[model samples]
Target: MEDWYYKVDEKFLICSICGYHYDKYAEYDEENNTPFRVEISGGYGSVHLETKKGDWIRIYLDGNLSAGELKAYKNVFENCNKEKSYLMTYEGNGFFTIHFGNPPEHFLISFKEYLENLPEDRQNDVF
Candidate 1:
């Protein structure tokens, strides 16, 4: 049997059920001194998502994504009309859908207020 494990931000997290190490991070902008790096390895039969908490969410592989498709997806994530935080959902095939679950607008104001108290560089790191 194949072993499965998850690694988040350099720490290896063992899946209790599979007893395998899955080391994956969702790191972006290596020059930014971030603590993680997003890596995708499985192909054809499986796709894995390793969150910052070292949790592995596995999904069956169904299709491939071209460079353009990937860029479009990232664009959607980075340039969405969202009032707060949001998540992405794959709508079968190779398309993706964005879902917004932002809290109340007032809460967002307060959250932003709190974030503003942090250093300028720290604010840029919110993803």
Candidate 2:
């Protein structure tokens, strides 16, 4: 097997609930030239992997994350095998990103709770 590490050639999203797999970077619409992405449909936490090697994170928060959601994100960012996770929030319509030096190609989208909540239960589990 080839040691394809830190290569953006391949990307995937794995579900932590039903153990489902999805294509992360395969968001391309031929007709409209738009990419449709499906994150963790139903799961406690999800994982996004990129063969490309880079420590960069960009997450858009639309007030969709459920309770303890932010904590989950921090959890993943904190234990990123780095000295410290740098986090910054902007004032642009909830647009935020994280820059990690030598970050792992695999991104574990941590969600505190997916279910067990009534109102936010139906919300899509994605940052």
Candidate 3:
């Protein structure tokens, strides 16, 4: 597997390969400095993965993810075992699923409730 990284610019969060953008600031709260909601659609709301052939594949997350949920995703991505885990998108679906391990374990991940409520010790456990 090749090294993969992502960057968050003023407008978008883009991955190294393909440079596909994801997570755009949408509605803001009264403070205006913090985003209350984020838009996740089209190529702008997708995760990019490099294939063995050096091509790129995208997992589109259509809909909205709260700031907390977004942070949870970032934590998981940053802490997970990159070589063993992958993010997957189901057809006609708008959420991301995490897959990992030798036996090929998988789980559907959506909303802030799931990720944010994990025990503090297990918060970074992505497997």
Candidate 4:
């Protein structure tokens, strides 16, 4: 995941559930200290929603997202969206979808790849 998308998704999740909206983490032009909403960072994994006015209520996930805490995550995001915060997730498919605004974003996360990256049985602890 791109670094800034986490922040965007954080804000997106908050907006989707709480119905509260604000652009708290506007991009900082450190050299100029100017506030610029980057909208979509790295062309993926980020959305620079310029306006702080919105009503995001209800978020959910389907598809290959079947397994373990993925359902819990879906429920949490759904409740949060109903309460008006936001998020998405899935299981072994190694991918999930995140919906925001006019369009949605799909992400990939390979558990097998992650396991391979881990040294020895360290992957066991990940479960």
All candidates in order of TM-score, best leading: 3, 2, 4, 1
Each prediction's Cα RMSD? Answer: 15.6, 17.7, 13.8, 16.5
TM-score result, candidate 2? 0.23
What is the per-residue lDDT of model 2 for residues 9-89, given as tens digits with 9 covering 90 to 100? 335554332233455454564665656443433322223322234554433332344537656765676556344333333
Candidate 2 Cα deviation (angstroms), residue 114 = 39
* Per-residue alpha-carbon lDDT of candidate 4 for residues 3-122, written as tens digits (9 for 90 to 100): 234544423222221122234355665765666442321111222122234434333322333366555554544433332233443333434345433333212334466557778867
Better of 1 and 3 by TM-score: 3
lDDT of 1 by residue, 1-127 (tens): 2222344335434422112344545555577577665343322222233444455444433345456755654455454434443333443344333333332333233446856776888775542
Cα RMSD for predicted model 4? 16.5
lDDT of each: 0.42, 0.39, 0.44, 0.37
lDDT digits (tens) for residues 1-127 of candidate 3? 0222224322445432222345544457565567544443343244544444455444556544466765665565565445543444333355434332221222343424555767778766532
Best by lDDT: 3
Clashes of 1: 13
Candidate 4: segments with Cα more than 4 A from true spot: 1-86, 89-95, 100-107
Better of 1 and 4 by lDDT: 1
Clashes of each: 13, 8, 0, 10
TM-score winner between 3 and 4, please give it: 3
